[model samples]
Target: MSAPASPQELRKLIAASSWTGPTAGVLDGYQQANLAVVPRDLAFDFLLYCNRNPKPCPVVAVTDPGDPVIRLGRTEADLRTTLPRYRVWQRGELVAEPTDITAYWRDDSVGFLLGCSHTWEGPLRTAGVPVPHAADSMAPPVYVTDRPTHPAGRLSGPLVVSMRALPGHLVARAVEVTARYPTGHGAPVHIGDPAGLGIADLSTPDFGPPPRLEPGTVPMFWACGVTPQLVLPNSGAEYVITHYAGHMFIFDHHVDETP
Candidate 1:
């Protein structure tokens, strides 16, 4: 496989449509974010939801209503066209999957950027933890769990998680590498058995592909960025916008080094 692109290079690649798949292997050192668009009226409550559930919904940045420019992360990045794809939601249902959101822009719309697992992938790989999905060029498997998150206003729902398989012996090292990047969903929430987290099967994921669990490997689960979308119904927002699974908003902020 080719060497991964740098963050800025990945941005250019994404802009040029040279890399339209997941941001997993691109941008080896920078942070990638999950997207959430809500009306200005419900921004506070959604922000509260993020604050209350840092594990699954770490708030990386927020955009002013009607402004597509993300000031806090990737100042030059436009929310309208930066990501490879977007998902449009109306009245709690997915209405469209588009690459650009310029058509949906509204004067009352606000954007929220949340931390994603891409931030931790590099560290894990460097430490020889073997992120199978990233290594094999596949998206991490995601599932909705039975665990409910703390509610804020109308925002409430079960937590969503992404899975990665690693050798049983290196599981602790995998946790150590990821624990250093707490903003990137931190460490695994559930390991070993998917059933422990109310997840019934590994072959069927709520999003992305089923994981290939190599012999001697154990499945590890981390809070997913998709958790926000799952919670959108409870948020009561009439409309919303988010990046497609594995497609993320590239940001300018440096990844946090502390746990």
Candidate 2:
């Protein structure tokens, strides 16, 4: 249908398969979420993983085992259908990328909603920072770094980061603005050269497209929610589902509502 006016409207559009694209730069005042659903057996391990790597896997809302709803008691949003797209992983390999995961939903599944960097892109724009991926259709480049997060149980993977190029003067201001939203990855983990993080090339991201940079603008990296997707493959889980990179779940509440 027409463009969604609010977060709830965007979610409705996504659920109905009307808007199945990157969720960044939409519903500016509301928060966006990265979704991870794993088996009940591995739930504790994933919970511990999130606790250990709070920057990339900051836990916002988690659903009870087998529940498809977000369980914040705010709305009837169904986890199986709210996000624009989902990645279904089985036996360490991705099996499907669907607009909705109705057939994939299981009774033993648990949904964990992690904070997304897209949540703070709105605030950054409000603060006059130029974010190149400000369009809803744009997805920022993500790279797997040499820095490894503290392992918890069976989950251990190199840190994955999303990149944004900013002018020299605006980098510090961008950090200052985003640091207020800890749940949304806080601030830049590394700035300038990507090689410091073991990234061989900025153009060859492990996920999403290449970086959008102008002359005099340097690349700044932020801890990414996609880190969980990388961790889950080696976690020995039989089945896992997550939102497609950059296609986040739109939350009705604002970022301040998160703890």
Candidate 3:
């Protein structure tokens, strides 16, 4: 199928299950977000968690308790059906990956739209820094790191980062380009040495496929939206919800704009 031309159209396609895969590189100029829905009882702690760890869990739009439609930059996007895929968690364990969570939806569930690095791909490309995953039509590789997030009430765990192998020269341009977009996990957290982050092998990512790197390219790591997913197995929340590995929600806001 041809690509949906606008965020609303892409959302509609996702709602209808016509697109049930990673949302990377779609709706190029608009912002794509990682979804995190937790019971209202655990909302404050999670919100605090995002606030304390802005780099990895940057907040974009958050739905009020029980409200499915997002009202940040746009008012029409619904959390229940807007994302391509969703993951349901129980006692810190992921139990389901579904197209829609209407069956699990609760009136007290709060949805969070966290900033995603995919939102920075356009700027990177504009700066002459190639976005490898976008060029390959794949999701960037995400991995769990030894770096720990500050504990906020009930949530705390290792940081997760998405890896991008950059040409040695463009690494600086990539950093400069992404730094302007703070809400989208601005700049590189680590430019080389995956071992520094406790990542043993780039080939065995915790989520998504291993990256394809050229001979002279060096891996650069950026704070990833997958941080919450990594935290889930350790957070004590009775229930949690998130987007499946590479699946994300598209929002009407542009990358430079705060939602």
lDDT of each: 0.82, 0.87, 0.85
Which window of ten consecutive residues has the lowest lDDT sum in model 3? Answer: 229-238
| Model 3, TM vs. native | 0.93
TM-scores, one per candidate: 0.90, 0.93, 0.93
Report the alpha-carbon TM-score of model 1 versus the true structure: 0.90
Instruction: Name the best candidate (by lDDT).
Output: 2
**Judged by lDDT against the true structure, how good is candidate 3?**
0.85
lDDT of 2 by residue, 36-127 (tens): 99999999999999999999998888998998988564655899999999999998899999999999999999999998888898888889
Better of 1 and 2 by lDDT: 2
Candidate 3's residue-wise lDDT over 1-259, tens digit each?
6799888888889888898877777778788888899989889988999999999998888898998888875647778988888889988787999999988889999999888888888888887888877876787888989899898887888888889997788888888999988777999899898999999999899888877777999999999887887775567777888988668888887887765
lDDT, residue 208, candidate 1: 90
